[model samples]
Target: MSAWFAGLLLAAVSVLVGCRIADTDAVTPVPQLLAFLPWLLVPTGTGLLLALLGRWWVGVVWGVVVLAGLAWFIEPYGKDSEPSGPAVASFRVLTSNTQFGRATGALLAAVRQQRPDVVFVQECDNRRCDIALRRELAVAYPYRQSVDGAGSQGSVILSRFPLEPAPGVPAAMGMPGAVADVHGHAVRLQLAHPMPPVPGGLGPWRRELERLRDFAAAGRGTPTIIAGDFNASQDHAAFRRILDTGLYDAARLAGHDRAPSWPSRTTPVFGVQIDHVLLTGDFSVTRARFLTLTGSDHRALVTDVTLHRR
Candidate 1:
C-alpha cells in the first residue's frame, strides 16, 4: 500500500513538472492550476517521508521535482539586471484591476497613499466611472487615456507626464499603448488587461498575449513599461513570451515576484501574482510592493523604477 501511494505521489509531481516546462495552458485550464504550483511542496515532503519509510525511489524522484520547482521559482530573479547607462528619470507606477470599477474608492485612496506617477487600471468599464476617476485623480494625473466598454473591456492609464497615443503600437484586444514625456524623454507606456482565460476565452487570451509580445518587440530601443492585470502569471508560457521581448517584470527585478496579488481579501491564501509591471530598455526597479484595495479581489502592484539614458 505504501508503494502504491508513493507511486501516485511521484506521478503527480511528474505531471506538474511537465506542465511547468510545456506550459500546457495555451488552450487549457493549465494556467489556473499552475497558479498553485508552489503547493507542490506538500507532495514533495510526503514523498520524502515515504522514502524514509523504505521507499528510497520516492525520495529520488521527489528530489528531482523539488530541484525543478526551485529553478522555475528563482528564474525571474535572475532575469533582472542593473541599468547599464546614466540615469534619465525615476518614477513610481501602480496598477490594479478594480473589479469592474466597483472598487473606485479604494483605488483612489491607494493612488493618494502611494502617489504613483503613473496608474494603470483594468475593468474600469462604464463612462461614469471613467469621469469620476478622472475628476478624482485630475490634480495629480492630468494626462490620461481611457478605453471604455462594458464588463472587462475597459482600461485607463493616468500619468503625471504629458501623454500621447503611441502611433507605433496599435491597440490589441483591450491593451493600449501610449507615449509619456518624462523630463523631455519619450517613455512608452502600455496598459495590459487581456481577456480572462475562462472557458471558450482561451483563444482570445492567447492572442492578446502574443500581440503584447509583438508590441514590445516593435519598439526596439525605447524605454517601455507595461502594467495592469494580465490574468496570466510568469508560469504561463504565453506571459513568458512577452518577457522574451526584452521586458523584465518589476516585481521579479525587486525579487518580490512571489507576492501574490490576485483573489485578494477573499481566499487570500490561495492567491496568485497575475498583475504585473513589465519594463525594458535601460530601466531598473528600486522597489516593488503590493497594496490591498477594498472591494477588489486583486491587490494593487506599485513599483519604483528608474530609467537610464543609454
Candidate 2:
C-alpha cells in the first residue's frame, strides 16, 4: 500500500510539472489547462500533507513548491506603476467585445457621444459590417479596417488619423492578421482575438501569444498598443508570458486592475476582467475603465492615453 501511494504521489508531481511546462509559450495550449490546475492540486496537496508529514521536512518542501507554482502560474494584474512619459493631451480609445451583432445600436450611440479617436471592436460579423455603421462612425473616424464575415472571429480598428497596414504577423495555429501603424504618433496598434481553448475547441492559444509577442518585439523601436478580448485573463500564465516580453498593460497602469468585464448582465460573486488593452514603450495611460453593458456578454473597456513626442 505504501509503495502504491508513493507511486501515485510521484505521478501527481509529474503531472504538475507537465502542466507548468505546457502553460509556457512552448506547448501553446497550456493556458487553457491552467484553469483546472487549482482544482487538481487541492486533493493532491492534501494527500501529500497527510502522508508525508511523518517525514516533516518532505511535507514542508512539498508545500512550498506547490504554493510557489500557484503563485507563478496565476497572475491577475500587470506590473503596478503610475503613468510615465511626458504629458501629452489625452486621446480616448473605446474597446468593446460586441457579441457578434446584438449591440450595434448601443455601440453606435457610444461612438457618437464619446467620439473616441480610436475604436476597437471584437467579435464583429460581416452582416453588421455595413455602410450604416461605417457612415455613423465616419463622423468621427475616417479610416477603418475590418475582417467581419461569416467566418470572422477577429476585430476592427477605426481611427480618425490615417492607418497604414503593417506586415502580417503569423499566428500560432491560424492565418496571420494585419497590424497597422497610426500616423502622427510613435505608436502602432494591433487588434487580435486568440482562439480560446475549450476542450476540443481551438487547440493552441500559445501560438497566438507567441505570434503577438514576435510582432510586438519587431516593433520595439516604437510604442505599440495591442487591444482585444484575448479570452484569457491576466491571472493566467499566458498573459504573464506577454508581459514578460516588455509590454505594459494599459488597464493596470490606469488603476483599473480589478475591473470585471465578462458576463455583462449577471455579476458573479467574483468577476473576471478578460477584456484588455496592453501597451509597450513610452506611452502613458491616463484612464482605463469599463463602460456600461450594451446587451453584450462582455462590458466595453475605454482607455485614455497620452503619448510624448520625444
Candidate 3:
C-alpha cells in the first residue's frame, strides 16, 4: 500500500510538471495549480522516501526523475545577475495591492520610509481610507494618475517626478499606466492588477495577461516598467509570455525572487511571490525586497533600478 501510494503521488507530480512545461496554464485549475507549483517538491520528496522504505525501485527512480524536473522549473527564480553599464538615472519603486484600501495608512508610511521615486498601487478603491491616502500622497508626489474602480479594481500611480498619460497604448482591464519624466528622459510605467483566476474569472484573467503581453511587445523602443499585483506568477505561461517580450523581473535579477510577496497574514515561507516589478530597455535592478503591509493580503515589492542611456 505504501509503494502504491508513492507511485500514484509521483505520477500526479509528473503530470503537473508536463502541463507546466507544455504551457497549459490558460486553462482553469492549471493556472491555479501552478501558483503553488514549487510546493510540490515536498510531496515528491516524501514519495521518494516512501518508495525507498518499501523497496520499490521503480517508484524511487521515477520519483527522482520527477523531482529533478520540478527543480529545473524552479531554478531560475532568485538567480542573481551582474550589473552591466553606466546608469543614466537611478530610482526606487514600491508596488502593492492595498486590500480594498484597508492598508492605505501602512502604504503611506511605507512610502515615507522607503522614499521610492514612484509608487504603484492596486485595489485603490474610493473609500475614506484610499481618499485620505491620495490626499496625503500629493504632498510628496505632485505628479499622479488614478482611476477609481469598484471594490478591488481601482489602480493609481504616484511619482515624485512629472507624469503624463501614455498615449496610443492599448488598454487592459484594471491596468493604469503613465509616462514619467525622469531627468528629462521618459520612463513608461504601468500599474497592473489583473483579474484573479477564481471561478468565473479565468477567461478575463487570461485575456488580461494576453493584453499585457501585447502591450509589452509593442513598447520595446522605450524604457518601460510594469509593477503591481500581477495576479499571476512566473510559473504561469501567460506571465512567462510577457517576459519573452524582453522584460526582466526585478526580483529575479536581484536574487530575491524566491521571497514570497502574497498572503501577508502568514510567514513568508507560507506565501507565494505574485506581486512583481518588471522592466525593459537598458535598465538593471540593483536591489529587490518585500515589505509587509498592515492590513493587506499582499506584501509590497520594493526595487532599486538604474536606467542606462542608449
Each prediction's RMSD over C-alphas, in Å, is 2.5, 4.8, 2.0
Q: Return the TM-score for each candidate structure.
A: 0.90, 0.74, 0.94
Model 3 RMSD, rounded to 1 decimal = 2.0
Q: Per-residue lDDT for 90 in model 3?
A: 94
Q: Against the true structure, candidate 3 has what lDDT?
A: 0.83
Candidate 2 accuracy as TM-score: 0.74
In terms of lDDT, the best-performing candidate is 3
Candidate 1: where is the Cα deviation over 4 Å?
Answer: 23-27, 48-78, 167-173, 266-269
lDDT of 2 by residue, 6-125 (tens): 446645654655666565423434444444444445655664565464555555466557656665554444565344556555577788776765666777877777778888887665
Which pairs clash (backbone N, Cα, C closer than 3 Å) in model 1?
none
Record all residue pairs in model 3 with backbone atoms less than 3 Å apart, i.e. clashing. Answer: none
lDDT of 3 by residue, 153-250 (tens): 67788899899987422334357789999999898888878888886678878878888888888889788998988888888888988888888889
CA lDDT of each candidate? 0.79, 0.64, 0.83
Using TM-score as the measure, the top candidate is: 3
The CA lDDT at 248 in model 1 is 91
Ten-residue region with minimum lDDT total, candidate 2: 172-181
